[model samples]
Structure formats: structure tokens, C-alpha cells
Target: MKEIVILGAGYAGLSALHVLQKSSADIHITLVDRNDYHYESTALHEVAAGTQSGEKISYPIMDVVNPKKTTFLQKTVEKINADEQSVLLTDGQSLNYDYLIVGLGFQSETFGIPGADVNALEMVDVKTAAKVYEHIEAQLKEYKTSKDEASLRIVVCGAGFTGIELVGSLVENTKHFAEIAGVKPEQIEIYNVEAADKILPMFSDKLGQYAINHFKKWGVKLMTGKMIKEVRPNEVVYQNGKDGDLESLHAKTIIWTTGVSGNKIVGESGFEERRGRVMVKPNLTDPTYDNVYILGDVAAVMDPASNRPYPTTAQIALKMGHYAGKDILNQMSGKASTPFSFKSLGSVASIGNTHALGLVGKAEMTAYPASVMKKVIADRSLLKTGGLKEVFAKGRFDFYH
Candidate 1:
């Protein structure tokens, strides 16, 4: 049997593994990851806020792949020798493959902002969630004992989905948390800073405004069109359009959700691009080699309609992985392939627990109904990735109920 070696056990990697099992591709498959299980990146903000447990966002990768055809290797990929058609694992083991799939996801892009890397806590994965959880616990402790008002300020950087959801949960949970901690609501303040003029600019203008209003009602402050010039342990300095002078805000906790670049390996592998994305042909293979395929955040898949690369999202990655698997099997069997086409089902960025905004087809919804639809889509993805039984066994569908 031929070999299909996939890197990074993310949406794309896991999806490809599933298709191979269902098709009985009989391809000797080895799935590699640095972590023991897959972390749900989409719902991470809620994880950080303590609304959802960390385990809710992770799944055993082995459960999703057939052991007969697929094997999971827990190790970091040190490097790739594309010229030699081999991959070097961190433990000094090397494997050569007939076909390689790169689905390495993304890393946080600090955008060269000062003090971002060292000071602010980032909400990335389970580990990061734990870190944020610690910070929140520390804040609550300080508020309970400390006489200083300075310890109650929380700075949330970015108005994107992650930032919004994190702050939203902080708003909801912190209120309950404050009662438990015996701190007044006025004592805790949350501020969301955005470089862009608006929040969730990817969504419609109306939805963006709704988010802003809801955040205000929830007691989250807004700082728009401002560039954070500096970030210190106790202060965040920014410059707004109206005043050339810098505006400084004092905060004890700073959570960064500005954005992310592609995974490190994407560029390190000698595939050229910033943020770790490489543009590939319609079949999703590298330009220089037919044996290598890149998907997920690592691939700069072109959107024919917009003539831009597809945003790195779970929906596109899942579909891209399926298509890439079919394409690779065709190549191995000496069969022609239909070019990879992107079918954008839709997009929904959730706000806190019960509010969301998105566009699916020509229709859009706001508030509770939109949020319920988002949960439906999430449950369906879980079902497809795992199975109806697995999805039901976990019973996450009850999140909406």
C-alpha cells in the first residue's frame, strides 16, 4: 500500500484521515501532532472565561481515525526535506512518503506591537486558556483583598470574534464571579480596543453595531480607531485619530486576541509567504512537488469569486481536506482530478453564549435565533468529524438548550 503522511492534527488533517478510512484508501497513514489531543480553537474564548470546561474543547485524535489504516504519532516535526521527499520529526526519526499533507494551522501575529509577547495573555489553545483562567482568578483574588482600585481593570485587545466573546463571557461570568468574590460591578471594568474603525468588520455594519451596543450594555468599554503604541504591565498606551496625543489606560490584566499569522512551519518549510500560507494550484499541491499538499491555514487557497485567498476557517479547511484526499488518491491511481473548488457554506462569529451574527445564503439573523443556528452548525460539524453516536455520547448539543 502507498503512504499518506499528514502533518498537524487539526481540522484539515483529521478530516483527511476520516475520508481515507471511509474510502478504504488502504493508504498507510501516519498523523503527526505536537499535542496529545485536538483543541477546539473556535470556542476557545468561552473556555478562557470558564463558561465551558477545557475538556469540552478537546478530543482524542485517535478516536476519530481507524487504527487499522491510520496511526497517530505524538511528536513535533523538526523540519521537512521536501527535496528528499522526507519529514524529520523532533525525536530524530525521519519518514519518507509518497504523498505529504501539510495542515499546520496558525500562530499569533503580534503585528510587532510593543510589550505584546511578554506581558499580555493570549487565548490560543488549552494551555493558553489555562493561563487566562489563572489571570482571571488572580484578578478576582486581588479585587477581594486589595484596597487599590487599579487591580480591577481588564484590557481586552481587539474587537474581533475572539476578543468580543472573551469580553462577553467576562462580562456575564464576572458579574456572577463578582458576587462570589464580593466585589461591586463598578470595581471591574473591561475595555475592548480595536485598530480597525469597527468591530467584526467581516460581518455586516448592522451586526457590528449590535455587538457594540450589547458590549456597552454588558459594561464593556470601546476604544476604536486606536493603535496601541505601547503595552506595559500596568498600562496600555494608544493613539486615536482625533488626538495625536497618546491615550493611556491603566489595567492589571491584558488579553490579546488581535489576530494570527500562519503556522511557523509554513514559511520555514521554504514555501514562501508571510503568516505561513502558501498559494497552491487547484489540486492543492505545492508548485514544486506533486507529492505534497497543503491545506488549512497553511494554504492560501484562492477564492475565485473574490479573487482573494479564503479566510482560514474550519468549514473551508474541512472541505479542502476532503478534496485533497480524493485528489491524492486519484493521483496515486493515475486518475485525473477535478480542481479544488471552495463552497463557502456561510460564516458565523458567536458573541458570548446566546447571541451571534452571520450571513448564510441571502438571509441573516441577529440575537438568539442566529446564536441557535450557530450552535446547530457546530453540532453538525462535530457529528461529521466524529459520528452521530460520538456526538450524542458527548451531548454538547445541550449547550444551546
Candidate 2:
């Protein structure tokens, strides 16, 4: 049996393990992740919001790694030795592989702003979400005895889906926690700061406007067209782009969701990265080595239609994982497998409970229907990855119920 080691059991790595194991029963596989549980990263904001606990978003990685054909190792990968066909782990040990797959998730990028690293709460993974949840809970408690509500300000830096969605979710949770703590709803200021001309710059202008409208309706202060010059322990200084004005805002809480790059190990390793992602060939294998494959956030793939780098999404990551897994099987078995070409399904984001915006194919949706679909996607991910048994173990037998 051939040994194929997959690093990082994220969306891509896990999906690859599932697909390739089923694709070839003769191949032996081992999946590794730094953490023991696989986090549902798409729903991490909810976990941070106190709306959902972090446990709901994470499943044991070993339970999902098929035992018949695969092994699971909870260890952090130190470096990849492409020349030796082995990988170094943090435990002072190494594993040699006949084939390798890289699917490490994202790392927070502060864009070189001061104090950003020390102060900003990064919504990177489930653990970070738990930290955000705990921090918010602690802050709310601390504010209960305090008189200055203005000092309880929360500044969410970035207007992307993660940032916008977090603020949207955070507002309601803030309100809930505020009510519990006897604080006025209006007292908790949730400000969303964006450097771009508009929020959700990747979405259509209309969609962005809809999101902005929703934010305003939720009492979230929209600070658009502002660049973060510096992040202080007690304040966030910014250059407001309104009429070329410079302004600053003070906040006790700063959640930084500005940008993300591939995990540190990959970028610093021998892999060639164009934008914190390995440049993989059509078959989703790294250009540097035939035995090594790159998927998910670690791989930079071009959109054939536009020739631009595709935005990293879970849908693409899952598909890319399967592509790599099957292609590797094809290569090892001397069989034929098709190159990867992702078919865009659609995406939806929850603004708040029972409120969401969805773009499925050409149709656009907001409100209840979108929220329902969002639930479906979230539940389906757990079911698909861990099967109905694990889903039920999570108390999700009937998805809608």
C-alpha cells in the first residue's frame, strides 16, 4: 500500500481524505491537524457572537478520519521536506510519504498596523472564536459597573464577510448581553470600519448597499473609506477618506478581520507562493513537486473565465480537495482523472438570526429564505463530513427540527 500524508484537516484536507479514501481502497492515508477538532470556520462568527458555542462548530477530527483506510494524527507540521518526501512535525518526529497534500487554513494578516497584533481579536479559527466570546462576555461584565458607555465601544476593522457578518451578529449578541447586564442597547456602539470605497467590495454594489442598510438598521455605525494608520491599546487611529479628512476613534474592543494569508508554515517553507498560496497546476498538485498537492487556502488557482485569482471559499476548498485526492489516485494507479474546474454554487451570509442574504446562481435572496438555506449549508457540512451518525451525536438528526 502507498502512503499518502495530508497536512491540515481543514475543509480541503478533510474533503481530500474522504474522497481519496473512497476513491482508492488500496491507498493508505494519514491526516494531520494541529488541533484535535475540525472547526466549521464559515460559522465561526456565530460562535464568537455567543449565539452559538464553539463546541457546536467543531467535530473531533479522528472520528471523521476513516479508520479502515486512513489514520489521524493530532500534531503541528513544522516543515515539508519535498526533496526527502517527508514532513517534520513539532514533536521532533517526521513522517515520510509517497504523496503529500497541503491544506492548512488561513492566518490573520494585520496589514502591518501597529498594536494590531497585540490588541485585535482575530477570528481565525474556532479557538479564536471562543476567545472572542469569552472576551466579549468579560467586557460586558466589566462594563456593567462602569458609567461611561462610550468607553465600551467595539471597533470591527474590516468590511469583508467575516468582519461584516461578525458585526451584524455581534450587534444582536451585544444587545442580548447588554440586556442581561442591564445596559442600554444604544449604549454599546458597534462600529464597522472599512478602508475600501464600500463594504463587501467583492459583492455587487447593490448587495453591498443592502448590507449597509441592514447594518444601519441594526444600529451599527458604518465608518467607510477609512484606513487604519495605527491601532493603539485604547484607541484606533485612522485617516478618514471623507474629503481627505483625518480622524480617529477610541474603542475598548478591536476585532481585526481585515485580511488573511495562508498559514505561516507554508509561506515560510520552500513552497512558492504568489499571494500566500502555492501556485498549483491544473491537477491541483504543487508545481514544485509531482508527489505534493496543494488545496484550499494554501493553493492559488486562477479563474479560467476571468483569469483572476479566485477568492478562497469553503465550496471551492472542498471541491479542490476532492480534485487533488482523485487526481493523486489517478497518478498513482496509472489511471485518468480530470483536472480541477470549480463550478460556482452560491454563497450566503447571516446578518443576524433569521436574516441573511443569499446569491444562489442568478437569484438573490434576503431574509427568512436565505437564513433557512444558510442553516442547510451549515448542517450539511457537518453531515457530509462526519456522516449522519456524527451529525446526530451533535443533536442534529433532523436538520430543520
Candidate 3:
């Protein structure tokens, strides 16, 4: 049997596993991940803000594993020897594969910002996301005793998708935070700092304005056009406007949502990469190895229309995983594999559980309608990675109050 080794059990890896495990092909699958559970990276914002528990967004990797064709290994991948078609694990076990799928996900990128890694909390996975909430709660509880106003303040660095979503969740939980600190919800200040003048640049200006309006209504401080220069303990120093004057936002909770770099293993493996992302061929295979497929955040598939890589999202990752599976099977059957392609359905940003804004196809959505669509999109993602069982268990069906 051909040995197929899949690394990382995130959306892309699991999606590929789901497709491969169903087939009766003469292949044995090895699924490797450090964690035994697969969590929705998209919903990590909710986990960080205490709006959702870590368990709510994650499910066991074994739940979807078909033992007859697949074996799950909880091992951290150290490096990939593409020349030998082998992977070295941290535990000293080397996995040799006839075919390989690399879906190792992202890591926090500080872009060389001073003290960013040490000072700011990161919501990379279930544990880190949960740590954010733990830190937030601890700060709030500290405010009750220390009566420090900074304890009630939250500064989210970067107003990108994750930052905006996290800000929304934080705003949603402000009342609970206020109660803990013996203050009003309005007194819990939430700031979203972004260097870009236009936040959510992927969406239309109108949709972006819609989110900004709601944030303003919810008392969130939007610090657009301010570039974060450094993250200090209980403070975020930023460059203010054209003059480049450095200013600081002092808050007890500083969450880093600036951006992410792909897995370090990619670079360490000696594949030509930028920020841990490989520019794969049209078939989604490594340029140097036809049998090795790279997907998810670590793989950069260029969009010919814009001459830039498509934004790394769960949607594209799923498509890449599915396509990789089909292409592998085709190759096994002695057929020509097709090139991978993707067209986005749309994108949505939830301001809170009740408010959202985005475009669905060509249609614009806002408020309750957009919120419902957001839940539906999340449900679709759940259905894709975890199937009906997981959907029923962790699906977002909170459409109405």
C-alpha cells in the first residue's frame, strides 16, 4: 500500500483526510498533529474574548478518523526532508511517505516589532485563545482589588479581520467585564489600532463603514492610520500619522491580531519560501516534488487577476484540501490531474453575535441578516471539516434571540 502522510490536523489537513479516508484506494494514511483535536481557527476570536469556550470550537481528531485506512499520530513535525520523502518528528520518529500533504498552519508574525511577542497575547490556537480570556478575566478581577483603570482597557493591535472580530467579541463581553470590575459596560474601553487607513480592505468601503459605525455605537475606539511600533508591558506604542510621532495606548490587555506567518517547518525544510509560504505550482504541488502537495496558509496560490496570492482563509484551504485529495486519487488511477481553482462565495465579519456586515455573492448583507449569514457560513465550515455529527454538536444556530 502507498503510504500517505498528512501533517497538521487543521481545516485543510482534516478536509483532505475526510476525502482520502472514504476511498478504498490501495493506500495507508498517516495523519500527524501535535494536538488530538481539530479547532476552528476562524472562531478563535470568540474563544479569546470569552464569548465562546475552547471546547465549543474544537473536536477530537479521532472522531473523523477511519481506523481501517488511517492512523492518527500526535507528534510534532520537526522538519521535512523532501529529497528523501521523509518527515522528522520531534520525538525522533521519521515518517516516510509515498505521497505527502503539508497543511501545517500559521504562527503569530510580529514583523520585528519590539516586545510584541512578549507583551501581547496571541490567539493562534485553542490553548492560546483560551489564555487570552484567562488573562482578560484575571485583569478584570485585579481591577476589583487594585482599582486600576488600565485593567478595564483592551487594546487590539491590527484592525484586520481577526482584530475586528475580536474587538466585537470583546465589546460583547464588556458588560460581563464591567460587572466583574464594578463598573459600567461603557467604562470598559476597547481600542482597535491599525496602521492602514482603510480597515478590511478586501471588502467595499460601505461595508467597512458599516462595521466602523457599529463599533462607534458600541463605544469601541477606532485608531486607524496609527502604526504600531512597539508593544510594551501593559502598553502599545504606535506611530501617529504623517509626522511619525510615537504615541502610546496603555491597557492591561493587549491582544496581537496583526498578522500570521506560515509554519516555520516550511522554511526549515529548505523549500523556497516567503514568510513560511511556498509558491506552489498550478497543480498545488511543490515545484521541486510532484508527489508532495502543500496547502493551507503555508502554500501561496497566486491569483492571476490581481498578480497576488489569494488571501489565506478557511474557504480556500478547504478547496485546496479537497482538490489535492482528488488529484492524488487521479494520479493513482493513472489519469491526468487538473489544476486547482477557487472563486470565493463571499466574506463576512461579525461585529457581535447580533451584528455583521459583508457581501454574499453580489448581495450586500448587514445587521441581523448578515449575522445569520455569518452563522450559516460557520455552519458550512463545520459541516465541511467535522461533518453532521460535529455540526450538530458545535454548530452556530443562534440565528435569533
Candidate 4:
């Protein structure tokens, strides 16, 4: 029997498992992850913002595992010895594989800013995301006794996709936070700090401005073009644009949503990588070893049109996962595997439960319509990974809200 070892129970890894479990290919699969549950990476912002519980976005890993053909291991991966076809676990066990799929997901990228990693809260996984809301609540609780206005201030360190959505979710929960602090909702100030003058550069100016208008309407202070210099305890230091004036914003809650890089294990395993991402071949295999597939955030597949790697998104990750499983099956059957290709349907950003903005194909979507599309896309992803069971259990059906 062939031994297939898949690492990380993320979107890419789980999607691969979903495909392989139904096949009678004389193969035994071992799925491994540090956590026993799989959460939607796209919905993490909601958890961090206290708009949704962590359980709402996550499901147990064993729920989708086909026990007859697949064994789930809840262990942390220390490193991968690609040349030896083995993976080392942090618990000091080594597992060998005939075919390996590496989809270890991503971590917060601090960009080497001083105190960013130490002081700023990172919402990379379910635990950390939950911690963010817990910390925010603690701050609010403290404000009731301390009466420190800083306890009500929230500073999100970046205005990227995740940061923007997080700001929206946080805004949605302002009343909840305000109730805890015994203050008016407007007293709980939220700020988004970004280095770029332009937000959502991937979308048109009109779409970006539409989001900005909502931020303004909702009382979210936008501090664009400010390069974050450092994150201190309850404060963020930044440089004011090209003029380079240093200023600091004090907040009780500081969220680091600046950016993310692939799992560090890829580089530690001797793969050629830049910022934890490997530029893989057209078939999504490691350039050095055909039997070793690297997908998700770790694999950098080039976009022929742009001559640059496509942005890492759950949409691309799912495609990569499905392609890897299919390609492996093809090779086992002595059939040629085809190069992977992807054309994005579009991208959408939800400001709050009821508001959103983006493009669907060539069509522009905004307001309630875009919000509905975002939920539909998320439900589609859940369907792909967790099937009908999870879609009904944890699906976003509150479209009217």
C-alpha cells in the first residue's frame, strides 16, 4: 500500500484529503496537524473581532477523516526532510511517506519591526483569534474600574484585507464593547493604520473609496500612509508618510493584521524559499522532488500574465489542494498530470454584517448585494472542504442580517 502523508488540516490540506478518501487507490493516508480542528482562515477576523465564536468557524479534524483509509495525527511538524522523504515531528517521531503534501498554512509577518511580535496581538489561528476578543473584553472590563479612555481605543496595525474586515467586525461589536465599559458606542474609538496611501490596490479606486466612505460613516479613523515603526505596550509608533514625522497612537488593544507568510518549516526543510514561500513548478510540485507537493500559502505559483506570484488566498489554496490530489491520482494510474491553472472569479470585502464592496467577475458589487456574495463564497468554500454536513452546521445562512 502507498503511504501518503499530508501536513496541516487547513483549507489546502483538508481539500486534498476530501478527494483522496473516496478513492480506492490502494493507499493509506496520514493527515497531521498541531490542532485537532480546522477553522476557516477567511472568517478568523470575525472571531478576533468578537462578532463570532471560534467554534462557529472551526470543526473538528476527525469529522471529515475517513478512518478506514486515513489516520489523523494531532502532532506538530518540526521539519520536513524532502530528500529522505520523511517528516520530523516536534515530539521526536519521524514519519516517512511515498507521496507528501505540504500545506502547513501561514504565520503573521512582522516585517522585523521591533516589538511588533512581542507587543501586538496576532490572530493567526483559532486560539490566538479568540485571545484577541478576550483581551479586548478584559480591557473593557478594566475600563469600568480604571476609567482609562485608552482602554476603549483599538488600533489595527494594517488596513489590508484582513485588517479592513476586522475593522468592520469590530465596528459591528462597538455596542457590545460599549455596554461592557458603560460608555457610549462612539466613545470606543477604532483606528486602522496602514503604510500605503492607497487601500485595496487590487481593486479599482471606486471600490476602495466606497469602503472608505463606510469607514468614515461608522466613525472608524483611517490613518493611511503611516509606516508602522514599532508596537509598544498599548501603543503604536509610526512614521507619517514621506515627511517622516514620528507619531504614536495609544490604544488598549493593538491587533497586528499587517501581513502573513507561509509556514517557516518550508525554508527550514531546505526548500528554496523567499519569505517562507517556494516558487513551485506548473504542476505544484517542489522543483527538486516531483513526489513532494507544496500547496497553499507556502507554494508560489506564478501568474504568467503578471510575471509575479498570485496573492495567497483561500480561493487559490482550494484550487491547489484539488489539483494536487487529482495529479497524484493521475500519476498512480500512469496518466499524465496537467499543469494547474486558476482564474479568480473576483474578490469581495465585507465591512460589516450588512455592508460590503468588491467585483464579481467584471461586475461591481457593493452594499448588501456584495455582503450576500461574500457569504455565498464562504459557504461554497465550506461545502468544498467539509461537504454538506459542515455547510448546514456552520454555514453563513444569516443573509438577511
The list of candidate 4 runs beyond 4 A from truth reads: none
Clashes of each: 1, 0, 0, 0
Candidate models: Cα lDDT each: 0.81, 0.81, 0.93, 0.94
What are the per-residue Cα lDDT tens digits for candidate 2 across 94-172?
9999999999878889878988999788889888888987887777677777755645678889998888888878876
Clashes of 4: 0
TM-scores, each model vs. reference = 0.95, 0.95, 0.98, 0.99
- Candidate 1: regions farther than 4 A off: 399-401
- Weakest 10 consecutive residues, lDDT, candidate 3? 337-346
The TM-score, computed over Cα atoms with residue i paired to residue i, of candidate 2 is 0.95
Which residue segments of model 2 deviate by more than 4 Å?
393-401
Cα lDDT tens digits for candidate 1, 167-217: 877776777657645787766788898888888877888988888888878
Cα error of candidate 3 at position 64, Å: 0.2
Cα error, residue 163 of model 4, in Å, equals 0.5
How does residue 332 of candidate 3 score in lDDT? 94
* 1-401 per-residue lDDT for model 3 (tens digits): 89999999998998899889988899999999999999999999999999999999999999999999999999999999999999999999999999999999999999999999999999999999999999999999999899889999999998888998999999899989888888888889999999999888878899899989988888899999998989999999999996789999899999999999999899999999999999999989999999999999999999887889999999999999999988888889999977898888988888878888888988888889999999999999999999999999999988886
Error of 2 at 382 (Å): 2.4
